[model samples]
Target: MDLRRLAVAAKPMHRTLHALPRPNCQDHAFLQMRRLATTDFSFLLPRRHAGLRSFSSTQSVPLSEVMPRDGSRADLKILPTDPDYLRLSVESMANMSRSEVSQFVFMMNSYGAVILSSSNRKEDRLAPYTMLDRLFGTPVPHDSMNEYGIVEINPANPTSINTANPIKEHLPHTDDAYTENPSMFCTLQCIQNAPSGGGETVLISGAELVAALSNKELKSLMTPGMVSLGRRPASDGSWLKVSSIPMFWVDKDSGWLQVRWRCNDGCVQSIDSAARPAYEQMDAVARHAIHQLVIPLVSGEVLIIDNRAIAHGRRSYEKGEPRIMWRKNYVGDGEIASELRNGLCPSYSSMFEGMWSMFEPKLVAV
Candidate 1:
């Protein structure tokens, strides 16, 4: 069984702190946060790996402290190499106050991405996914691959299943843009760094692009039927499942903006011929947005993104240098961790079939 599967059940609840002690900032802001966003958080974290113990599945588990067992403060560095910026930590994340939680949420909502300077233990991926699951809903797991484990971006070692390609520069695009319900949020944790220093992560803000586009471009984007194309690879490295999705849509329930932009050659060809002009305009605008924020992530840091509001990509790195990253996706606004403890959401094929079934009729109508 996978470690993640072990974490879902049988593991006892506990916390791991960093080797060094940290300051306890019990200020007024912290107090206010504790007063407001009180949610029992221990059930969401992975239990201590070394000391395995049993717990009653039916009993109410006390929330444990989040231990910083992975990366250290020294490993964190700001993009463009700024030395004075304050580094964030993943230690004790389960114990953060309501205000602190609100701040993180606010940053993600407003800026479309938030960076946390922290260490990642093998089990540390649970911290962010659990937190997001508590605040949002269950994380929609990756379909093409099970385990949702470490995805190493090794170009020289491209596999049929992995999304991270080390040698190739990934253009700005939403992760799983090909899926029916693309992951609502994506979290990336760095475990190893490239030796030659090339693969910087690039981010583009949808909100920024929306604000900058002319009314004509906005109208074209909002004009309903711009299909973005993509494919799923089979076990034998063959592309088996081809999919098409609208580039942008408004969620009927939330009235919020959602996007499915992919600039890859095949994806671009999937755009409706009638909508080519609009696609060209959107392409230009998206390029401008990403140029504004390029981030170089090193080991011991995590980047969380709002999938609906931002598109992210990786810069090409020097060949032969190694880079490894862990990624997890979470879904929902009100879902909890325990509900999804057994496993992530349905497989991608099933989810996509359902989405396409509903969409085919609409496409015909259009």
Candidate 2:
């Protein structure tokens, strides 16, 4: 967590928390997939709410017909030549007075992740912060406990939110699972590499994960309500119980899916007894999907992934070996460029309790 690196201002930010009403045709994937495959529709039927129907499968807009997923897609293996790779290299960022805001947005929208090249000769890990600030105006503080916007990803000093052991495999999860808005994008700037080369970065696309699951499983996972991810005990002798969150949701405006699943957080905690099986099954499937794309990061590379669309983790390394990386989380600037990010459509909200209120029928029924 490179929490100390960001520049904070005295003036208060002008941001609003209210989100747009949930659209009728938000998630088209499950609907379309259901149409293609004759699975049980009994669980997914629309429920009458105050004499008004909530959702109907026949009304859902086809995602493929509306917006094809043919945009420039690249995973963690993105190289320099890949169009998804941001050209904000150490040299380019150093040479130019301002970061290429357009390029950053393009790469972010095209691919859920981008590999930023750092200077081999010098430690230019700090350069990405300048570029990030330009792209996303404000850096959201990691948590109330640690107010720093950036944090050094040292396994030795794991935070309370992350209690996993340093040498153990860090499971795939999005940063700040305890909040309504986790960072829209996260940067992992490599500072030091382990001598034995055991630690590797792992990334999993949420879209791909849903694609792998059956329609029934997808519908079950999207059920709205609190997921009971546990609590956050602070130093003030007070503890906050964090519960009732969703794992996967979609943008009402774009129909683009957004996922927020952390093994340590809401992924394992099922508040609803009936949904426990679905939640557990989702975790197992997510673990399977993440193993498909593992990336090795050396000392001079920074990886920026869409926090909402992709899940990331680290491989366990030897005890004596050294591994160091700086991490920073950035929320959408509400500016055009930052809003264009893959999972950050304007009406974005924590779909768990907000836009997905309509799922109460199936979610509770299960």
Whole-model lDDT values for every prediction = 0.48, 0.51
In candidate 1, which residue ranges exceed 4 Å CA deviation? 1-91, 119-127, 144-165, 211-217, 223-225, 232-238, 265-269, 288-290, 334-366
Q: Quote the lDDT for 8 in model 2.
A: 25
Per-residue C-alpha lDDT of model 2 across residues 277-320, encoded as one tens digit per residue = 55565567557732336777777677888888778887778875
The sequence of per-residue lDDT tens digits that candidate 1 reaches over residues 41-76 is 332344233112322222322111111112221111
Clashes of each: 9, 11
What is the TM-score of each predicted model, taking all chains together?
0.60, 0.63
Q: After superposition, how far is residue 100 of candidate 1 from its true place, in Å?
A: 2.1
TM-score of the candidate numbered 1? 0.60
RMSD to the native, candidate 1? 17.4
How does model 2 fare in lDDT? 0.51
